[model samples]
Structure formats: C-alpha cells, structure tokens
Target: MHRFNAYRIFEKEGQVSARLVELGIDDLDPGEVLIRNSHSSVNYKDALAATGTGRVVRRFPVIGGVDVAGVVVTSGDTRFWEGEAVLVTGYGMGVEHDGGYAEYSRVPADWVVPLPLEMSSADAMAIGTAGFTAALAIMRMEQNGLKPANGPVVVVGASGGVGSVAVDLLAGLGYEVTAISGKDDQHEYMRHLGASQVLSRHTLEMGKKPLEKTIWAGAVDPVGGEMLAWLTRTMKQDGTIASCGLAAGIELHTTVMPFILRGISLLGIDSVQCPMALRRSVWERLASDMRPRHLKEMTRTIHFEQLPETFDALLKGAVKGRVVVEIQA
Candidate 1:
C-alpha cells in the first residue's frame, strides 16, 4: 500500500495535537520489519502520550500506541519472515518512536515478537502490554517465592486493564484474589474476573503506623503512591509486591520497616526495555495457562477513528478494562 491511515501526534505552538492522517510507508521510521498492523490497544501510558497530559512522549509527531499485533509484510531480519504473525510493544513505542495506532507499523527487529501459535493478532492485542505487565509482575513475584499456597494476592486498581488481567491470572493460578478499585460499579465486574472479593479503594485506609495487619501474601500494584505504602506495611513476611503504574500518584512515603523487619520484596516492573528472553517467556505464558479466560469480555474494541474520544475517557479514568483498537478491517 502506498498510503494508509494513522493517528499522528504533533506539537504546535508548544501544545500537542493528535489526529487521524494519511501517510505513506516512507513516513514511518526506518526499521527491519514492516507489519500490516491488525490491532493495537490503549494503555494508561498511551492515553498520557496521546493527550499530552503527561511527559509520556519525549518526541513530537509520533503515533500513540504502546501495543501492536499483526502480520509481517516485509523483513530485513533473518529471524522474522514475510507473512509471519508478530507483535511489537514497549521499548519507546508511541513515545520516542512511531507506534501502532495505524494501519501499518515499521519497527526494529529486536522489538518484534513472533505471535504465539495459540494467539491470534486480535487476541494478542486483547491482552496487549497491560496483560504482559501483569504477567511479568506475577512471574517476578513467583521468582521471589510467592505461590498459590502462600495466601491471598491483592490487585490494586483492579478495574483497569492491568489490574483486571492480574486478578484473572492470579485466580486462575489458584491464588485467592482481592480486587481493590475506586469505582463502585466495578465490584461485580471484578468478581467475574475471578476476584474472590472486591474492596473499595477507601477500604484501604492509610494507617499511621510503620506496619499494619499482615493481610496480603503478595500484591500486583498499579496504583502506587499511598496504596503501595499501605501494601508494603500490610504484607506478610517474605511477601512480594510487584509495583507497576502510578495511577494514584508517584510518591512513596513509607518507612523501611516492612523491608527490613519483614523481608518483604518490592519488585519494580517495567514492560518497556524488558529483556527479549523474558519478554518471549511472558508472551508464551500469556498465550497459554496465564491467559485470561474472559479475554473477550474484558476488552472493548474500537476503530482508529475513535481514539481521540477514547483517549479522553481513558485519561479521565472513565474507561474500564482494556481498549483494543482495530487498525485494519
């Protein structure tokens, strides 16, 4: 195709603007693989980048999508071949590089992951980077000695994409899950995702002590800040906390008592710049047993034209679960 539709973000008058535009292949950044992108998904980071609400995009005039899955149309790398199913996520995508909110994406070979046999492009995107991060969190927690027999796993921000997937994966793995969210309406939705119990965000009151009740054996925290501090205090001895996003806030004001006295581990999860070997392993797990059973139910698919409106919803915290963007018919 000589030209295709893409959602481009541009900086003008010191303000960022985004729109659907027509662009040619040459407009894409030089890369080894040219993918006919079928689906991409909106993460919290994508919303930040698209709306310029945060310093998510370092460079101007980039596509705003962190996750992409499609068919490889051309390949300069020996490991990838034409017509092979593949995906690209993270590693400066939609930030410093042109991303997946388009009909086509040309990205570096190192950033491309061959889609697993059990996963379709749409399915891969349905999970997307959000799910990938959730899986990575679980993997790291497990490596740190967390197990189904340990106790309960609490998922903060449990109504969002990453949180919902974390709930499902942890429950599917035989761990009891307590989902915590600020949205009152999402209680039933979180339960359906296999959360044994759903708690309001307010229920996790900030205790003024260095340590609180040891309730959680592990936690998948995307809503950092005070919530993370709370988790750190309430975790069981030797428990692990996989900290991801900062939907609540970024600051963590807490004493070192939990880490020193309880030996609790705080694992930082960064989907971007995650090593390829671990990335492949995580994707493979997501395509298999760790995949959310309610994958389709947990996702909302929209076209590329709907991104502007969707970005607003995502930024305002109105969108729930995953928002998958269909890049092709």
Candidate 2:
C-alpha cells in the first residue's frame, strides 16, 4: 500500500455545494490495478462535475476527472504487469465512481486499456476523452457513408477539444475540412490543424428560412441546439451530421425537411456506453491512421494543484485546446 495526494469533492445530501479536500490513496475505490496516474485531461463532463452543474456525478465525494493515462504500480490481473503503461476513459469514470484527478487511482483491470504503440502516457492523456470522442465520431461517420471523398466536411465548435482533434485527424486523412468557430483568435490555430476554411459561428445563426443553401457533405458537431439544427438544414443531400455535444443547448428545433426532403442522416455520437467491440476498433484506428500529427503542439499540460483555477476557466469557455493534468511527480 502507498499514500498519495488527491483532489476530492465531498457533497452532502440536500446540498448543492461541494467541499474540496486533498486526501490519500487509502480513500480510492476498490479495483485490481493501482495506478500511479501520470496524466489526465479535462472535458466538458469534467467541468460539469467540477462545478456541480450537470448531472455528471450521482455519487458523493467523487474524484472528477474523466480521462487518465499512467503506469501501473501494482496489478492483480496478468494482462497488466506492474510498470506497464495504460489509459482509461468512459465506463462511469468521474460519475458513478472515483476517477483520474487523483495522483493514484485503483481501477478495475477490465477498464484499463494498454497504451498504444504509437502513444506515450502523456500523449494518450493529451488526446484524452475529447480526442477519443472525436475519433469515434469520424468512425461512425465512415460507417454511415461519410467517406473521405464525400465532398467537404465541416466541424462545429472547431477550436474546442473535440473539434481541434477532429480537424487534425480528418485533415490528416486528406479530407477537405471547414471549421466553424466563435473564436477568431483560433483562426490560425485551426488552419494549422488543416482546416481549409474557418466560418464564424454568427454566420450560421437561426434565420427565417427552414432551409438555406446546402453546403458541406458531412459534419462533426460538438455544439448542439441551433448549431446542430442549422447544420442539418445546410448539409448536402444524403449528408451525415455526427452530433456529439450540447455546449449550446439540448433542444433541437429543426424541421423534417432536412431528413425527409434531402435524405440527410443525423448520426448521434455517444462516447459513453459505446460497445466494447466498437471502442476497441476506434482505439486501434486512433493508434494507426487516425492519429493526429501535431499532438505535442496541441497539448496544454498543468499540474494537479492548478486544477481549480483551470477548471473555472474551462467552465467559462476561456480555455483552448486540451488541458492535460500531471498527477504524479
């Protein structure tokens, strides 16, 4: 047994507020492998958990990071020996159980994925849940006929975590990418990720018409609500829109014209509860063809103690790119 620092949140019943505390390894949940967590990344879900906003956590006194990449310090399962590198995401992390925010985490062996040959622990966390979701979106799109040759693909929320990685991966695969973003400061950054063009979010705002001129052949949307509805109407006939987030809102007020008249396909991208078979396949693809080129350039690393301030900014939409936390010294 070992001792380590962890950022914890304790919430009592009938209370909306959470008490922040730093605790030890003895506090972790039961599992087979004890990982000396090296890195973790913040996601929208993490932000929700951090701020007690979304229903991201049903359990009280939970650790609130959804993605972790680290080295195993002790293992009860043969598949992962001590010192082996691994990563974990989804499967109730930061929600139903303790998660990656701690310097040390004990997780069930089944939830652990060995680090890919192409990725280091830090690199894996740099991609984290956001990139994993992005990759899953692309894979689902391809399965539904959104091929690389399917004209041009547009990515909404283009400067955010999922958007940034999606732009990089799609462009690397030779797809023509048009980025839609509200932040003009990210224009050069988006271009660096291989976006052929960047459209202002205001340009796609709700208008009087039910349908406007059709443009992109496919789309990866992380901003739902009006942005998603607008994309559905504007996408080319038989186009596919992979809807992943609800950063804008959950309501999708769209006409049936886009689906019935244009034969457009709206694909829902669900990273959590994705079947194991598909999850394994997506991870393989991420290790191989789907891996982004400039991962190091896109990563933003922070120490564990800095999480509070960083998470505050992230909740306010002030953060750019992925924010990976270095947990263990």
Candidate 3:
C-alpha cells in the first residue's frame, strides 16, 4: 500500500532498460529495516547498473544505487528503532539487490551501519562508497607499513570521487599528496582538498622502460592499467600501492621488476563484500582521521528526478567529486 518513487532497472532477453516509476512497498525486496532514503551517492558501479553497460546487476528490475543514508522509519530487528539515522553501502547494492535509487529501501538489518556520532546523513553519503574506498586504501597502506614520514603519496585519477577523497584523506594524515589528474580545472580544487601538488595524467604516460624514476613512497590508484603499471615501477623501494577501480582498464600489463626487485606490494581493494567488522571501523575512521577537510566542497546534491541525467554525466566523466541524490524529494 506504500507507494513510492523508484528508479527500477529490468533486463529482458539479455537487454536492460531503466526508468523512474511508482511502486509500492510490496514490490521491494524483503528486509527488516525500511529506510526513507534521504541521500544516495553516485559511483561508477551505479552507472553500470543504471545503464547496464557492465552486466553489474545480477537480477532484473533492480534499483541502481550502491550507497544510501537516511532515517529509519520502521524496523523488524530489535537492534534498530524508529528515527535512527543509518547508512548502507556496498555488499552488492544495486547489483544483486534492491538499492538506494528510490525514495525508500528495505535492506537486511545487518547491512546497515549506525551513522557515526559526528556525521549527519548528508555527510555520511557525501563520503559514500568512494570515501569509504579511500579509507580502506589508507588502511591497507598502513597495514603494509606505509608511514607519513616514508615520503610523498600519489593518488591517480585525482579529480574523480575515489581519487579526490584519497588525496584529501592522505593529506589530512600529514602525508604529502601528489594528485595525478588530466582535468586541469580540478587543480585548485585538489589543492583545497590538501594536495601538495597536482600532476597531469600525461606525466605518467609511456616512458619506454620497465622501470622509471622512483619518487612516490606509496600510491592510491583508481585508474588502473598503465597508471597502475607506472605506479608499480615508480614507487620507492619497499613501497606499496593500494589498487582499486579499473576506470582506465582491467588488464595490468607490466613486468614483475617492481614486485621482485623493489619489494613493492600491489594491494587490491574491494569495497563490496568488505568484512562487516572492517566496514564499521573504516566508516568510524572516516568521521575521524580519514575525514577530508573539504568534503562539503566535493559533494553536489540532486533530487530523485535528476538521477538519469546525472548518471549519464557520471559515466562520461563529466562530473567531478561526489553526487548525492536526494531520493525522498
């Protein structure tokens, strides 16, 4: 009986289509916690789900958003109660289940994270999966012995969501950050997020050697492929690289010289299906040490009706930073 607005994607005969339509509560997937979705952030995966370009959605008629934050309206689980703010991210949202591109979302209680004490619903999604991924990358680097004093850290695709957040978080932690981006327009924005320097993406392109000059102590890479290959070879001896995203491409073509000779580690990061315990810790840390100083500046708010156009822009890389959809409106 509870009708709401939703962006639903359906696949028929191997073809996918999506549209914003009206649906009722009974149409949603079964779950214990019902969220009145206030905000959901855009991710590259969301674009894939919305447009069906990557076969991301494992099921038909799925909602397409991987992150959501809002107040709980009702709950079947005792661990949560009415009026409590919460967030949901990763774990195949928009890919394998109904997700946050709607005015309401019903998800398993276990998938919910109590919003950090210091973070508001808007701020929670402003960080979204991208910032969470950035936090995870930092955590991975730390576990691999990366320290602020080790030297400068580099973030590739630095104007995009994951890279922007990584740049800000690394710089906030007192590590010098070199941002690699082709969008010259983002230079000042990167600086505002605490980047020590911004390098053109062209600087990392073909240099005709298996190994190049070593400069970075470590790197947070979202633009894999050649950028990852370059980072692998150019990192300082014993350095590590937290590899996430394949915006560039999935294949990594390179020699093993960096790993064998330099002892550099290529650490892969996956926000989806990240352990619940680590998920909670990473989010808590996002409100603390990993919180970017300019998170507000990096977020743009749009309403539910605006999702389609924005999704297109995000896929074309025409949008920068984070985009939070005000689903309820």
Count of backbone clashes, every candidate in sequence: 0, 0, 0
Model 3, residue pairs in steric clash:
none
Task: Compose the digit string of candidate 2's lDDT tens values, residues 1-329.
Answer: 54566666666664534434566667889899988888899898888887777766878778878888889999999989998988898887887778998888888988888888778888888888899999999988888888877799999998889999999999998999999998888889999999999988866555657787888899999889888988888888899999999999999998899899889999898887788778777888888998888787787888866787887887777787888898865
As for lDDT, the candidate ahead, 1 or 2, is 1
Please, what are the lDDT tens digits per residue for candidate 1 over residues 1-329? 67889899888887888999999999998899999999999999988888888977899889889899999999999999999999999998899999999889999999999999999989889899999999999999999999999999999999999998999899999999999999999899999999999999866576889999899999999989889999999999999999999988999999999999999999999999999999999999998889789898899999988888988998787888998998885
The C-alpha RMSD of each candidate to the native structure, in angstroms, is 0.8, 1.7, 1.3
Q: What is the C-alpha lDDT of each candidate?
A: 0.92, 0.85, 0.88
What TM-score would each prediction reach against the true structure?
0.99, 0.95, 0.97
Q: Candidate 3 on 1-329: residue-level lDDT in tens?
A: 56888888888888888888898988889899999988898888888888888888998889889999998989999988999999999986888889998889999999999999989888888889998999999999999999999999999989999988998899889999999898887899998888988888865465757888899898999889888888887989999999989989899988988889999999999999899899999998988877778888988998777777887988888889988887763
Q: Evaluate residue 129 in candidate 2 and report its C-alpha lDDT on the 0 to 100 scale.
A: 88
* After superposition, candidate 1 runs with Cα above 4 Å error: none
Best-first order by TM-score: 1, 3, 2
Runs of candidate 3 with Cα error greater than 4 angstroms are 203-205
